[model samples]
Target: MSFDYDLFVIGGGSGGVRAARLAAAEAGARVGLAEEYRMGGTCVIRGCVPKKLMVFASGYSGAFEDARAYGWGVQAGGFDWDIFKGKLEAELTRLEGIYTANLKKAGVEIHAARATLSDAHRVKLSTGEEFTAKHILVATGGRPFVPEFPGHELAITSNEMFKLDQLPKRLLIVGGGFIACEFACIMNGLGVEVTQFYRGAQVLRGFDDEARGHVADLMRDRGVNLHVGTDVISMEKTAEGIAVKSSTGHDASYDAVMYATGRVPNSDGLGLEEAGVRLGRRGEVIVDAYSQTSVPSIYAVGDVTDRINLTPVAIREGAAFVETVFHGRPTSPDHELVASAVFTQPELGAVGLTEEQAREREPIEVYSAAFRPMQTLFAGRDDRVLMKLIVSQATRKVLGCHIVADHAGELIQLAAVAIKMGATKEDFDRTVAVHPTMAEELVTMKSPTRTA
Candidate 1:
């Protein structure tokens, strides 16, 4: 067909980059990727990298205060917002360069412009260049969705939160998802007067309820004004900063109001309508099980597909798409039992089904163990760890495992492997406990809290 490239991928985020690189290298297929903005996409530049840096920076503030209990320091520790911002920018610039170099190493052509699909097999860049390919992959990912409320323009999304010139003295974060809660903890720990407003009765609405409650308590203890069951109607700029007017008629002023409410698929401006790609109600690109859109030659991956939006999951989907499409290998991503972690203070990590999801299928059993960790015991801190196992009644298989602790992320990875391998409640009990570790609580638990 004399195609310019074997595969033309739009969006150089996690999925797009992985797909293009692997398709070029392994499939020996010519690949071209177009990105109008930063090469690394949401995770590397704004979402994960910068957020984690802020988390680390905020931890130091808490660490300095916690050090008093350990008899470590006498003098005060101070932080300069300018210094932190400069460091974050330097690291992000380095990451963008690495992403570009990776594409070059993989023999993939990179186009620094937005790509709009002219047809299922053809894409046109904003530069007025047209390229035809055997297949087109859409991996534009998603962006923070700020609702259209009065004075919403005055509110900042998570995207701008990282690049702010000055650190907010007082912050009002709206919503209760991972984005909202995570930011609240980070900023509050850094000594900001942080207030969180969520319309729902609880924060982290989709996660396990116990995990959400525990995290909520931690946020409260850390001095975050957690206001659940309230919605902000509008925001107005005050002489001081920004004033948030709640739907309940409660109003408050803060230096900045961050709408960490949610994110929408970046399916806009891609000319999908003309190309005949069906999108979901939330604007997510609808794809088949093998990552194919309605049109066979077009594929969509990453957040654009509205599947698991985690970066690792997107990378896996992208790699699988290339293998199935070009290499003729019938492959699909196994999304089940995929472990993930939320980087709030005292981190939350989980894999497989939640206790609620497990109960829906059959008569299930849940085992839990909650106690003060050794580190907290030594410091006389009241913080406790939560570990739970959700077992299938029919097969006695462990369907889900969740952990809330300091090293929950690292600990849950092993649990994820176990769940993926179909490990049961008996298996966890049979495993010997690793002594002097917080993770040991997961296996040493003996009783079932509830049997459904």
Candidate 2:
């Protein structure tokens, strides 16, 4: 069939850009991509990049304290939100430009407008333009979901966090997820009086119980007024910022309230259902392992499919889509043992099943260690780190690896490679430990803490 292009990709996110670029540059197919907002989408524009920078900025307060204890003369000054925000905005602009230039370099036509499905192979843009393509790809990601509550409009989500006019003196964070916990810690470290309320019994609900509990304790120790099993009953705007009534029957006023509850797939109003594309209950585009949707010519990836929502996973899904469709390789993006990190005060890095999940599946041995690392110990801080490995008794292979400490994210990435390669307990033991290092515990744990 004659078409305007070989592939028309809606949403110029990491996934969409990767697919469009690969199809055009590698496979020599004509491609076009449309993005209503920024070219870099959520991760580069708001999610990972800016959040990590905040993590870095917030850690300096603790670092200065540690430096003093270590005989280094260092004094921490007040954080300037204006200066930091200016630099942050500049960096985002630079990144967005790179994303645009790369797509154009790969010969993908870029549209700075929202695109919706007209039919199985047709796309209608907000600019009142229509294009027919041989195939269509939807890579529109997700958005922060804030529940309807009194004065909710006054509350900000993560999207507005990076763009705040000034850092709030008192910040109220709601939600039990990583986003909430991370921001609570970030604001607290930045010298804000941070109060966090999670309706759940514990924050980071889906993670390892021990690791999450340890994090919650440290957050409280680090001056985050964390209240679990509690939520805001209502919020009202007042001259003195936000007046919040809590489920605990407490009344307080905060400079700002931020909701990090969750995110919903950006699948609505995209005309997917009209085009015969199946959508899940959460509005996630339903797709096969290869990312092809119900309609033959339409496919979806990234958060739109509600698969692994990480940026790296989305990029892989995009590449796999191009491989399967354009290069005829029939690739399916791997989703197993994906390592992830919660960028809380003490980060939690995890890969594979939790001890809870492993024990339910099969007999397992859990090797765990909790100790004060040399660096923190030397600085006279009571900070502790956790290293745990869940191993299958039958196969002796490591079923899971979880680390809770500073820079756990960096550590888990290397550990993930070993776990992904099917390394066993003996294999890890055989590798000599790198002494005087926090991560050496991963290999040096000689005994199982518990066998189930």
Query: Could you say which candidate leads in TM-score?
Result: 2
Worst 10 residues of 2 by lDDT: 146-155
lDDT of each: 0.89, 0.94
Q: Which candidate ranks first by lDDT, i.e. highest?
A: 2
Candidate 1 lDDT by residue in tens digits, 286-317: 99889999888899999999999899999999
lDDT of 1 at 355: 77
List the candidates' TM-scores in order.
0.98, 0.99
Give the Å shift of residue 412 in candidate 2.
Answer: 0.3
TM-score of 1: 0.98
lDDT of 2 by residue, 349-396 (tens): 999999999999999999999999999899998889999999999999
Query: Which residue runs of candidate 2 sit more than 4 Å off their true CA positions?
Result: none
